[model samples]
Target chain A: MKHTLSVLVENKPGVLARVAGLFRRRGFNIHSLAVAPTENPNLSRMTIVVDLEGKPLEQVEKQLHKLVNVLKIQDFLPHEAVERELALIKVHSTKETRAEIIQICDIFRAKIVDVSQDSLAIEVTGTEDKIDAIVSLLKPYRIIDLARTGKVAVSRGRK
Target chain B: MKLTGAEAVVKSLELLGVTDIFGIPGGATLPLTDALSRTEKIKYYLMRHEQCAAHAADAYARATGKVGVCTATSGPGATNLVTGIANAYMDSIPIVAITGQVATSVIGTDAFQEADITGITLPIVKHSYLITDANEIPYLFAEAFHIASTGRPGPVVIDLPRDVQNQVINFKFPEKVNLPGYKPTIRGHTRQIKLALEELMKSEKPVMFIGGGVVLSNAHQEVKKLAENFRIPVAWTLMGKGAFPDNHELNMGMIGMHGTRTTNTAIMNCDLLFAVGVRFDDRATGNLKRFAPHAKIVHIDIDPAEIGKNVKVDVPIVGDAAIVLRELNTMIENNNLKKTNHLAWVEQVFEWKKKWPLKTPDSTDLTPQFLISKISKAANDKDLIITTGVGQHQMWSAQFIELNGPRRFITSGGLGTMGFGLPAAIGAQVGKPNALVIDIDGDGSFQMVLQDLGTIARYNLPVKVVIINNRYLGMVRQWQELFFGKRYYAVDLEKGSPDFVKLSEAYGIKASVVSSVSELDEKIDEMINHRGPYVLDARVKEEENVFPMVPAGASLDEIIGGD
Candidate 1:
């Protein structure tokens, strides 16, 4: 099973390396990780998706909490949280195929961020499934390049 | 008061009650060294190597239960401290390591003697700091000591750049730490304690499995009270050697890969295992599937990550060992729970212990076990602090030595570093100046860090070094003899080895060599009574191996040489 953890840490140099080093040394499998500044200037929040097949969830949480910089951690269940991913996909385009690519983007609620003579760059932001679906739809147009900001999640509530 | 960062560092250390620091001076740390030399509050001991300084600091912390301090210059010097820092991390010893870094402008340029020490030590330390400004020194030093000495104590590193050290700033020590993320859970939850007590009352064959946390928390008395109050047997891990009296009737000695036959048997037969302050490492739990198969485990530790880490627990309590045990003892007393007589179980364990006593070979040549036994007998009357290098001699010392108080037996249990004994002995001796410190070392392991003999001789510390001179790396050779069909690949240490006695003499210390069993006791007594540092090289039987062996992957019950 995959576990999505939202971790709050002090905004300091090398904090990311410490967290990443711990996961590496302890042999924890990290599926995806995204870090960004939080509302507080002195703190940052990290969204990490980890594969917890053989390892215990409590142990991982405890280990993360052991790092002095880590302030808080929240393990989100799929139903109780709102999750999202963003991807920018560049597709090869011809004058004949450009109209079709724009139509697919329109259907998926995506936007054409950049356009060149031979290629069109499309940006999509949604749940992982929606991003995957739109990427698959554009695969027929010859995907020249693709980039993804891995999943970021938050619990859906006022607890 | 306005002061340079170097002066602030010295001031912070003095304010934190640090009386001594072990380190070596070099190019990068010259500024700090100059400031330290001018300060009269902290005495500095110059070490031959950064690693030895770190090990010495580690042992000093282990002996004193205070955060030990060590320092080094950048790059190579900082890199050399890795092993000792990792050793402290593995054993959970509290230490503060300060390393000098290059100037901020030249940090990324690969300047002379510059290294990203914080990045290199990220995985090993509890926390690390790379100072960006001189003002952060006071706060960082306070935080470093706080983090290093609290909640599952471990090493913390502070990397100070040369320019930062030279910069001046207003110096005022923080009245309190502002870390909101690092509060430790010191008291056990009442509901968990009640549930644990209910399980304990219901258990017929119960064993209290203790580890290093008991020693770390100074909860030896609490552990003894809980065990004796319930008529339960106590089994300890190697790190928990001195947590309970070895001569106590209920003490089951050590439990794990090299654990006693009776201790392993008792654990395997128990109905409930109450483990405190133990991580249940692989060496402690041989073949985890078969370990304590019949027991419902109740584990209590300060670190929540250790709860279900290696083995699953039925009842898990997260709290400091001393506090939790005290709470449990209070509940036990308040409930007026009648002590259940476990005569049958106690008798069964005693029978096993008597039947499978640890044996010594009946030979004219001095065996490691026999020599250790003689040392134990000779040192029986004094307050002894025993340290060891990792290998056959270490196990022999653990098995034969009688430890009655906490922090008496110090060794690298988790890391099992080869060259730990000599420097650790020095540190322990320095920490407890009144006690008799002895390093029971192996020939191979001793040769790894014998350069510290100079440190001992210079300090005139009365630390006795007993080298069990077996011609081969005896532990690895034993494994080869048993599992690898005696191929004996690179296990020999006979050739190109310095004469330890001569080496000690050259270092201006008293030295002796004992090869016969008849002279073992007399020589050990002489070494113990020596006024200053002394080395005794006792050449034991070359092929002797530690026995009642548990093959690497075998279950504890499948032990080989009991009879």
Candidate 2:
């Protein structure tokens, strides 16, 4: 089972390492993680999606709570939260293939951000499934470079 | 109020009621130690090595019920304390380790005498702090102490860089810590406590299981009362040895791995297991699959993470051991209910206890069991403390030594660190100056930190060291014989093993050698009667192995009776 854990940590040096080290030490597999500063400058929010491999999410949360730098943790069920992922892809483009690539980007609602003599860089942001679909569509092209920002999540309901 | 970070650190420790600390100073520690030297409130014990220093602080915490303090310089000194810090972490001993760090400017640059002690100890400690500002010294130190000694006790490391120590500020020590994420649950839920009580009341073959938490919380009295009221047999882990008095009828000796056959039988036969302050460590539970197959587990612990991690618990009560037990005891008393009689069940356990007893083979000459039993019997004082180095001697100490109170039996139960005995004895003696502390050690285990003999001698701790000199790492040799067809790889220590008696004498401590079985009692008495630190190296049979063994991954009932 996959678990998306929204963790609020003290904004300090080595907090990221502490969180990463804990997951590593406990043998919990991380699928994706995105970290950014919250509205409160004192706190940073980390969105970590982990593959528990039939292990209880409660165990992972309880262990995470033991870290002093970790201020709060909320495990969001898929339906309870809104999640997004961003990907930037650089694909080989030619005079003949550039028009076809632009059409595929339009169908996915992705924008062509940069154009070089031999490649076109497309920027896309959507649900993980949408990102996965676009990456698979672009795999046929000779991909030059790819970068992904792992999933960032927030609860669907109130503050 | 104006002071440097080093002075603030010393002032914070003084305010916290710390009278003694253990460590060795280096270049990075110069500023800190200089500030420490100005204070008469704390006396520092200079140890021979950083590892031994940490072990001493650990034992001091165990003996005194105070957060033990130790310090070391950067790099190798901090790295050396890792073994002892991990030992304390595993065993859940409350200790505060203050390490010197490189200047804040060169922290990540791999500067001279630089090491990230806080990061290195994150997984091992309950919490840690790397101080960046001198102004936060008092607050961080207070927080460190609070986190270390509260709900589930463990070690905490504070890494203070050299620049921070030298930075001057107006120090204002806080009375209470304000850590939003560091609150521990102290009271058990009323519903869960009631459920646990109802379950225990209905259980015909119930058993009370305990671990180091009970000892750490000093919940022995409550445990005894509850066990007697419910007519339940009490089985304990090695770390829980002193939680219940050995003389009680309900008391079952150490259970699991090296546990007595009697206790293991009772645990396996029980219908409901009331586990208090236990983590259900694999060594204590043996095979979790078959452990207490007929039992419904009621686990009450301070840390929620420990619940259902090892075994699925039926009624999980998260709270401090003493608080939970005290509430339960009151509930039983106030209800005016007639408790079910478990006389038949108790009798059944005793019958098993009698059927298979611990029998040590002494066909040839001196046996380790005989020597330990003699010392245990001779240690009649209420204040006498027993510490052990890991291996055959540790198991023998757990079995033969009779403990009637908490904090009297101290050993590296969780991490099983060797060379823990001698330094622990020193710490225990230092903490309890009027108490008699004895370290029962093996030759191989003793050789690891033998240099610390100078520390004990210099302090005149009046601690006694008894080496169960079998001339080999007996526990490993036994495992090789049983599990590996007697390969005996690296288990032999007969060649070039130090003469411990002469070595102790060389360090200005009293020393003796006892080669005959007849002189075992006399030598023990002499060591006890001696006014200063003493070492008694007693030669025993080389092939002696601890009995009533349950092989790894085997159930409790599958114990091999070597009798």
For each candidate, C-alpha RMSD in Å?
A: 1.2, 1.2
Question: Given candidate 1, what's the lDDT at residue A119?
Answer: 99
Candidate whose lDDT is highest:
1
Give every collision pair in model 2: none
Per-residue lDDT tens digits for candidate 2, residues B332-409, read 999965566567898898887677666656565888988888888888764789998999999999988888888988
| Per-residue lDDT of candidate 1, residues A99-125 (tens digit) | 999999999889999999999999999
* TM-scores for candidates 1 onward, in order: 0.98, 0.98
Best by DockQ: 1
Question: Which sections of candidate 1 miss by over 4 Å?
Answer: none
Candidate 1 C-alpha lDDT tens digits along B478-560? 99998899999999999999888889999999999999988877898899988899999988889987877788878989888
Clashing pairs in 1: none
CAPRI category for model 1 = high
| Retained true contacts (fraction), each candidate | 0.81, 0.70
